[model samples]
Target: MSRLTLAGMALLLPGLTLGGEWSGYVEGQIRAFTQEPQFDEQGDSTFSLAFEPEYYQSWDRNQQSLTFTPFLRLDSQDEARTHFDIRELLWIYAGDRWELHAGVGKVFWGVTEALHLVDIINQTDLVENPDGEKKLGQPMLKLSFEQDWGTLDLFALPGFRQRTFPGEDGRLRSQPWVDTDLTTYESDREEQHLDFAVRWSHSLGDWDIGLAHFRGTSRDPSFNPVVNRDGDLVLAPHYEIIQQTSLDLQATKGDWLWKLEAIHRGGLDDPFNAATGGFEYTFVGVAETDIDIGMLSEYIYDDRGDDAPVPFENDLFIGLRFTANDVQSSELLTGLIKDLDSDALMFNLETNRRIGSSWKGALQARFWIDVPREDPMHAFSSDDYIEISLARYF
Candidate 1:
């Protein structure tokens, strides 16, 4: 075994010896593309396997705890995709109305389904997933306090992680692959710069609101196209300092959920405003059965218009979710995002169900429709694909 794997096992020894809680899953997935490979030597299909193991140890009558979660992935097509990550390795202390966390961890801070404009704590692991939901663990010191009016959270982040991208042999990337090794940072301190953020959240009656501010290097990076020695145009990631203010609100009434997220970012060429608002309505016990169905609609707007990096500017997203109240616990979610300015549309479907007590299966598919050359998604127009996975839990 590798030294890193041995070290991870050493970290888990305490929980195993002390009889603490342990859980995790092992999964294997296959992805099949509907179109021809975009680049030479790229396969139309790929396979990947991942294993995650978590251990938790508590002391002082559960007042203090330590959590260790290690993840590893192996890909059949790209050697760059074979990686290891410590998703969570933290020590947590909980007091009467306060909490302290130290170590590497993950924090999610957004409510929008289509895009997460405000969730910027950790660097994204883009090669792991296309939806930007997967994130690399961040090193930080966090403190939170609960008061009558609201809950306040303070974070001191110290480390920066570069985003991962597919290799030349990968089927999902553009013709010129991104070179993550040549990343550039505007700040002289580079990735070693210290970052901080604060958040305040409150719940009043049926409404839940959160306000946050971050001053540090932006998690999202801009690309600079440069010709390499091989005469190939490659994109290099560039990170810059940014100050962002974000607001997120949600209201729950009966079977309806209303959501809104807005953000204003400074330190760019021009400050911009972006927002998304949506609502979801659920029909419980559909047709007197044990199934529940939910309908979702959201509007996305960005002041940058055509200059925006994402195709979500002036877009509409509609989705449906189904849940089956059964022992197997089955769920399905499907959504579509349509651009109002151009003929760009993207559809996604995800479904998962339990095979037994310790096994589960999942299926996911994405379809691009009528993509226009002006749209940012045009590069991925031919990359529509389906993925299926089966996982075993321990």
Candidate 2:
């Protein structure tokens, strides 16, 4: 279709459509961030430009309905890296409330506050592409249902000769544990493994709840040299498993809103087998005394596992937020926080500003005191850092 036709469809169909609809958004941002490696560790910095532009068109000419969504992303400065790239292409066919989607894309399985138990259905945020962005996009086929009572999603990743089913010894293994360096395994062309996931969401009066499950092979093992300890070419097979469950509740009364989220992550492949798995729960309560001003507090609890790469095996934080206008068009947030296990304190600040019709800007900073002296798996965390970004929508 012509650009004008698509633009017209995007603008008019949301209100006029009867059967099929065409809609989507384009967003881009530029950001700068810095990190100070703790314990005399090597420090790194980054500046980035990112984009997420999508276009989706759906049509139901008769009993058959079709949906086509194409997405593109480009980011410079992912974590400690300098550049990143990925693509998303999905097509769905539907009849009534049931539909099927195929190809590569992104999926948010459930609502978990800690982001630890929340599984990003593609690549588990454990690693990133050369450009620094998490490889959260993957190839798969999905089935979904959206009804008045609830929503359900079931998907499977097939075709790839990947492996993530607990290995023969039942010990979760990764490339770093098997080999000293991971060079070839980090590329997209070499990825091999089948992944699957399912998610469900329902609503009860003032509360909404969701359940999610994911099973996939490990990305860290895909690039193993397939050699033996004696330097012989031994084809030893390895696999990993990640099982998760979560519960979330939210209610609004008068000027107060309360939210609670709990998650349990375990299975054969979690970082630590010393324990069944680990859990991180979060609680958030907020009250609005005026249209432009509000007060809020958050609590977080973390449990460490043997294989887990994080420090102290646990952490916590509490804070407050303020807005300058009734519309919340602009806002600022700050708080004094303590690290539950380490007994460290920090000052954190974050702000957001909206622009005319199509753009927004954000700034985030954290000041750490008595920072730790260790580096965790994947990338290193910072003792102090500032992140600023501006996003525009087309």
Candidate 3:
């Protein structure tokens, strides 16, 4: 075994000795492409396997606890995708109205389904997934307080994690490869730059609201195209310092959910504003069959318009979700995002169901239609694909 694997195993010994609860899963997945490979050297299909294990230890009558979760993935097509990560390694102390967390952890801070404009705590692990839902663990010290009016959260992030990219031989990448190793940072401390953030959240009746501010190195990187000494084009990742203010609001009434997220970011060439608003209405116990279906609509707007780095700058997203209140706990979600001014559309379908007691299965598919040349997602126009996975849990 590699030294890193040995070290991870050694860390688990403490939890085992302390009689902590242990749980995890092993999964294998297959991805099949509907179109030809974008690059001749890349394959049209790929396979991957993952093993995730978690351990939790509690002390002082559950007042204090430690959680450890390690993830390992092996990919058949790209060596870069075959990697190991510590998703969560944290110590927590819960008091009467306060909580403290310290270590590597993950924090999610958005309510929008189409895009997460306000969530910026952890770095994106882009190579692991195409949807950008997976994230690398962040080193942080967090403190939270619960009061009558609202809940306040304070975070001190001491280290930064770089975004991972696909390898040269990997599929779903741009023509010019992104050299992640040769990255540039605006801060002299680089990944060691200290970041800070504060968030306040409150729930009033049927309304939930959150306000947050972040000041530190930006998680999003800008790519600079350059020619190497060998006259080959290359893209280098660049990080810069930035400040952002965010707001998230949600209102729940009956079987309807209304959500909104807005952000104002500075420290770039020009300060810009972005927002996403959506609502979901559900029909419960449809035909008295215990099946619920929901319809969703969302609008995303950005001040940069076509100059925005992401494809969702001026778009509308429509989606549907189905829930089967059955023994197997089956669920399905499908969505589509269409550009307002161009012939660009992206569709996604995700479904999952439980099997027996310890097994589960999931399927997902993504399709792109008439992606415009100016859009950032044009590179993935030919990468429409389907993925299916089966997991065994212990």
Task: Name the runs in model 3 displaced over 4 angstroms.
Answer: 1-17, 227-232
Residues 246-310, candidate 1: write the lDDT tens digits. Answer: 99999999999999999999988878999999999999999999999999999999999999877
**TM-score of model 2 vs. true structure:** 0.62
Q: What local lDDT score does residue 69 receive in model 3, on the 0 to 100 scale?
A: 92
Q: How far in Å is the alpha carbon of 269 misplaced in model 3?
A: 1.6
Regions more than 4 Å wrong, model 2 = 1-45, 61-84, 112-116, 124-135, 147-149, 158-190, 218-239, 252-256, 269-296, 305-307, 311-313, 324-328, 333-337, 345-348, 374-383
The model with the greatest lDDT is 3
Clashes in each model (backbone N, CA, C under 3 Å)?
A: 0, 9, 0
* 174 Cα displacement, candidate 3 (Å): 2.2
| Candidate 2: C-alpha lDDT | 0.48
- Candidate 2 lDDT tens digits, 165-234: 2111111122222332222432253345456777788887866677776666543342345655656443
Q: How well does model 1 score by local distance difference test?
A: 0.87
Estimated TM-score for each candidate: 0.94, 0.62, 0.95
